[model samples]
Target chain A: MNIYNKVYFVLLFITLISYLGGFGKKPRYVRMVILLMILWFFTSAVAIYLVKYGGLTNNLFVFHISTPLEYVILSMLFRDVIVNKAIKRIILLSVPFFVALSVLFSVFIQPVDTNNSNIIIIESVILVFISLFFLREILLLQQVTVLHRFPMFWICVGILFYYTGNLVIEGMLNYMIRQSMELARRTYRFGYIFKYLLFILFIIGAFCSKSPRLLTKKEQ
Target chain B: MIISVTVVLLILLFFIVSFLFIYKNRQVRHRAEMESVKEKYNQEILKTQLEIREQTMKNISEEIHDNVGQVLSLVVLSLSAIELNDTTKAAAKIESTTKLVEKVVSDLRNLSKTLDADNVANVGLVAIIKFELELLEKTGVYRTLFRLSGTEKKLNGSKEIVLYRIIQESLNNIIKHAKATMIKISLDFSDTQLQVEITDDGKGFDAGDSGEKNMHRSGAGIKNMKKRANLIGGSLAVKSVPSMGTTVSMIIPFSPAG
Candidate 1:
């Protein structure tokens, strides 16, 4: 819609390509983790664009897909953590809590005291659940040995770096607290730039690691 | 109205792109994984084939060294014992060459006898091994010994050939390189395993360095033995300490039908 948004979208698209390119002979689960992260960023950007620019996108299904998608991705990435009976029960209990939280945040919670209270109330329900799922996914990843294994460790590092880039775009959406508007804008630029750098790092790390030899998976 | 139509179109396009990317990427990755696994399997099959070929060669060598070699010595002895006058001394010289020709004949026989497919089904394993050792013992150079413990039973021909080849190769190693006097061969059937041990008091080489030092490619012997063992679903090990002695053990799982 604007020059700044155009630049942001371009940066985001580049990051998406880099993420797609990470799929060398990496195992299925590891590849899934990266894919989910990319989806999160991509969809988040789309959601932000929809909210800022008036689009006739009024259907509930448009944004509702994110919640279910996030839930599935989070479950897969942290199956080890969520697989436990107690933990699954807890997650099940958290579903309603997330629904409530999303509604509350989208409406009552102030991001620099927003002017449009009605719009906030509606989107907050979806945002709360998606954020919860994403956070749990990250937490589950912590339990998985992805960070410790040879090739995966590097991939994991790259993901973390790429996620840092998302923070830049996220900080600008004004959905969350921002100490300074100018600082938020600057952080957005820094984060996007950092994300691009991480994408490059992922390639370098993938090539250098001996995972292909160890797993005997050929990278095509 | 235009804006609403655009938004709906964008949402549908989003699903199409997501499905296309996920499906295309999955296809490529799956193909790659399958190819890698296929490559590894091929290498293993090739290695197994090489081992089988080597073992076949060793069996031929043993038949030559034990059976043919003995027959050649007898021919030489008979030639040496013949009385020849000066006039026939030249003929005696000609007679000696006959033994040399017999050597070639016997070498050919060695090749044929070892590869004999009927050895598996005909005669059985015990008789074949007994026959091989009896031939070697007739040499009188080394008193070769055979001792068996545990229940006696007929084994699958492939298993027999493998065990026989292993025994044949270890003895060949002792006969060719290990300059030892007494060679003891024993078979023990215990713990669902058929264990064959051969010990020689020959000028034993250090086994720690045997693998590294014996770079002199006499591998037609040891290589064949290992390959035969592998084919028979067994493992072979050789232990040699310098100057003391050398021991070769072959373990073939027999019970529960290994």
Candidate 2:
């Protein structure tokens, strides 16, 4: 693994540790995020091992399988946090539709062997929209007096930054690769910075979480 | 290419920083707004408490003058007429005077118990309101009816006081202006809310005169009633029609404490 991959794994490790420290206290949606992070850690490890040691030239197919799963997990997280009933129902209904679209794009258009830029771009767009929508809702709510202390607010911010960066980087990946593989590799390495940012924000979110029991009592 | 990539990253960072700044700014503004609301609510509560005290004192003054004073004056006349030589007659006079004295004591006791601000919490809102209606009935000028439905629930003491004052203000308006012979007050308690309706049969004014101009022309009683209701997270509505009388309705949500 390169130095960037090593550093990425370290950040992921720190995020997981932070999440574990607050595992019992964190709300259900936050626990789901911990699960997502764990799944991501394992999938990333496996994908890297396949590329470096399993005699595989490319591990883009791993992402093809993981992308829809990641979307489902993140969508579920949003569904829980968002208060609007109709928006919640739409988010619920869109999950299967999103998965089907991802499958179709993988099988017919992009193919699993190539970098799944199309799926990543679509995923990025949908997630960025949802994140922005969540931020808007939180702003309107005005319930949380201290927004920084709110775990979901930080998570939403993290999602916004990560997905927005992903949208731009992945949108250019295929074109960059076709023009010059060296340039694509350089650009892809830059995308790791957002991953680092996502993990750091996740750590902050984990630490910011108040125990659900305490929250319930405070509300009462 | 490197500079373009740097610019994109810089823009992204700037967007995030701006969002944080905006969010923090909005949060500060929200906190300030909430503090102002709380301050206004506290002031209203203080004002309501003072109003209740003032109303209680006024009721006591009126009772002493109209009822107790008249009864005591009659007792004084009865005692002064008793003669030593007419023993049997004097005994009868003494017996009636003793009875009158007992009644005066009872009336004073009841008045003290009901009119004291502290007893509002002790007697509960319904009993206090029922007592008020009973006093109106005793006047003989107006027939007052108090009907209560649903299970009675106790609320926070301050909230109860504010509610009582709102009801008192409504009744005061009726007594001063309604010229209605019959007054009806109904309290309906549901799981979620307590609804109070006060209806009077008298010469009513134009309900449509409730515009801003009319509100200023009429008086501050209705506006004050509405403000008191809102202070306790409740609502007040006044409906009046010329020759059809006026009805004041107030609804208060049951708090978790209730």
Candidate 3:
């Protein structure tokens, strides 16, 4: 394995261990995030095995099937955390619609033999909007006093960072490949940085306890 | 291509770091705002406590000069006039003196009960308010009426004190400026809220008038009452029409945990 894959596996392993350690202690959202991480680990391992050892040239179909499932889980996570009724309704409605679009794009546009760049770009955009909306709502409500200690806030930051990076990189991936294959591979390696950030932040969020109120002078 | 991708990644990192920086700044601002609000609330509570104490002292002074002092003077006069020679006259004088002394003792006891502003919690809000109305009735100036509907629920001690002070301030306002003959106070209790209405059949001023003269007349007292109400998470509304009397309505939410 190359240095990139080695680091990727190491981060994935650590995140999985951290999540499993907190599985019974954390909230439902944390458990949902653990499930998403497990799905990623499973698909990634299977795809790597088939490509490296099973003699299959393309294992992009595994991600094609997993992408919509991941989106559904993420939408559920957003729906669970967002308090605004209108935004929640929009998330609730978008799940089925996005799933349909992903299926159609996979069947006709990307064909599951190539990287699902278009579908990823779309998913990343939607998630970026949701995460921004969640952050704005958190800012307006001022419910959590210590933002750093708030689990949902950190989870939101992770989502915003990952999806934003994903959106930009995936939007340009196809064009980059047409210009130069080596450059495309190098650019694609940068996507792993975002993935590492997502899981590392997720681990931080999974371990976070409920934030305590700021202490007054008497309390101190 | 590599250069472009690297620039894009750099820009994305900058965007995230800026977001975190902005969010942290807002968090600090929010914390400072909350502390200031809490400080203001504490100051108001202390001020309200002082005002209640001052008002109680004034009431005690008035009761002594008007009721207890006069009655005691009469008792002394009756005792001094009693003759040891005539049994019938002496008995009559003694009897009247006894009655007068009894009344002084009763009035003193009632005044003492109201002396401690903090006793509102132990005596209960309804009883304290009723005692206040009874004291007003004793003046024989303004006819006072009190009505209560629904089951009485106890609130937090500090909140009860604040509510009582607001009501006392309202009554004081009516006495000082309303020039009204009758006052009605009603408390309506629901499952989640308490509604209080104080009405006076007085020569009321125009509430809509924001002129300097009108503001000078009743501005500070009304503003203080409203502020006290708000500090306790309640709302107060004063509705008055010239010559049509005035009504002060207040609504406070009830928290069972408190």
* TM-score between candidate 2 and the true structure: 0.86
| Interface C-alpha RMSD after superposing true interface residues, each candidate, one decimal | 13.7, 3.9, 4.5
Candidate 3 lDDT tens digits, A102-180: 9999999999999999999999999999999998887776666566677777678788888988887898889999999
Q: Which stretches of candidate 3 lie over 4 Å from their true place?
A: A1-6, A22-24, A46-61, A79-93, A103-114, A133-154, A180-182, A204-220, B1-31, B208-218, B255-258
Tens-place lDDT digits, model 2, residues A74-123: 99999998988998998899899989999999999989998888888988
Best by DockQ: 2
Pick out the ten consecutive residues of candidate 2 chain A with the lowest summed lDDT: A211-220
| Residue lDDT tens for model 1, A8-117 | 55655554455456445755544655665566566666766666684635423334445445545544443332335665665555556555654455456632234322
Q: Write the per-residue lDDT of candidate 3 for residues B194-234, one digit (tens) a residue.
A: 99999999999876665445445667887788778888889
**Per-residue C-alpha lDDT of model 2 across residues B1-258, encoded as one tens digit per residue:** 467557756876787678778877886786688678778877877888788888888888888898789889989999999997999999999999999998899889867965664457888989888888888898899998889999998878878988988888888988898899999999999999999999999898885654555455557888888888887889888877889998888899997864
TM-score of 3: 0.83
lDDT of 2 at B2: 63
Write down the TM-score of every candidate: 0.34, 0.86, 0.83
